[model samples]
Target: MILFDQIIFGPIHSRRLGLSLGVNLLPIDAKICSFNCIYCECGFNTTMHDSPIPTRDQVRETLDAKLHEMVAEGQIPDVITFAGNGEPTLHAEFEGIIDDTIALRNKYCPTAKVSVLSNSTRIHKPHIFAALNKVDNNILKFDSAIDRTMKLMDQPVGKHINVAWFIEHLKKFDGRLIIQTMFLRGEVQGEKLDNTTDEEVEAWIQALEQIRPQQVMMYSLDREAPTQNLQKVSVDELNIIAEKVRAKGFDVSVAG
Candidate 1:
């Protein structure tokens, strides 16, 4: 089922939203993201390419045409999410897309939310922060609070990135920030790693409290990953950690 996925792919059932329509802003031939996490489903980044950037007008045109068709067919969705092969924020006209997408949704289906599943690499950009503030939900990634484990798990693009600095930046965002974490056990580069341990989970909770995100979405692998050694954490383990976050008065959801 993997090919060049069109601009919209599901009203596929989602745990949080009943049905979600995806928006793919990156070029279809290769995955585009700042971090090459071992568990990413689109596979790893072989080389960086910058071509075929979708213009704001094109995004509006494609999305409008799809929404019009969906409206006529009465196929309403719970959300219109910015998620796809890679990071949606990488799109040059991200702010424009957010503005246009919200306007189109209001015209066609006002009940549907404009949401984004971003990695939070570009949250430092004032424009990106302002754009994300307009969305109904801004789900950002924060896999591990420890620097050494973060490098092992996320494999970020540059050496300058620090977890502490990222956490600080996220705290200042003037919108609802939903933190997303992927819990798993794996061996990468011949080294064994586990992120579901008590100490690791405690550190993550501390970061959540410091950032004070509006919500948290915790889940494990659901598709084939680039790293085969990674094992999905069980529901029981997820619930134990989730309860700890919930006790701190933060809403948490365990997605399958």
Candidate 2:
């Protein structure tokens, strides 16, 4: 329901990335993503538009202009984030755009970090992997470690995706990636779903050990989700989960 109308929309405060400037590569009026997540703030993928994605030149021009303006106003952001309508890596010129963004950030706001929020669906693509490696924060999502729970939660576009395959693919990043997970419980359609259970958490912890990310970001919903059945997990529960992950010798942060 929150559709961004411009390529550069905010220098808004982010829970993780402070004073962030959002870059939307997808269509302005609709959601464009590979996953039809039940808790997506932009609603379901079925409601997305058929509009063509923005051109590399268009993104370059818009982002450059915005950075110049922010610099002149002495309002440089802490981070330039690639997140908006949907999965940003889906852009045809994603690699070129990342190059452009990095160049502009260096010129106008040299101290600012370049970050990308990816669904981790396209990491197998050589170009996408290379582009992600160039950014400051290569944040990837993995909500559940169990195949059945992942299928129920993420609802990925490709039915061939499985937890085992996904985990193996994630290990390709080694320790360079930042893993982000959203903790919640609810029922969609008719089946009961919960990822905070000991079984789910233990499985997720084991997977994280294999991937061995630099850090893990754990949080619960803070906005109205597309699915009304979802319930936000408490902060105390999140801390407990974070501790479990921390006990494994990996750094973890909890957000509610």
Could you give the C-alpha RMSD of every candidate to the true structure, in order shown?
Answer: 1.7, 1.1
TM-score of 2: 0.97
Q: Ten-residue segment with the worst summed lDDT in candidate 2?
A: 44-53
lDDT of 1 by residue, 117-196 (tens): 99888888899999999999898999999887888888888666889978988998743788999999989888878888
Q: How do all models score by TM-score?
A: 0.95, 0.97
Candidate 2 segments whose C-alpha is farther than 4 A from its true place: 47-51
What number of clashing residue pairs does each candidate have, in the order they appear? 0, 0
Clashing residue pairs in candidate 1 are none
The sequence of per-residue lDDT tens digits that candidate 2 reaches over residues 1-256 is 6877888889899998899999999998788788888888887774646666789999999999999999999998999999998899999899999999999998999999999999899898999999999999999999999988888888899776788877888899878999999999999889899999999999999999899999999989998898978999999999999998999898888888
lDDT of 2 at 154: 86
Model 1 TM-score?
Answer: 0.95
**Deviation in angstroms for 201 in model 2?**
0.4
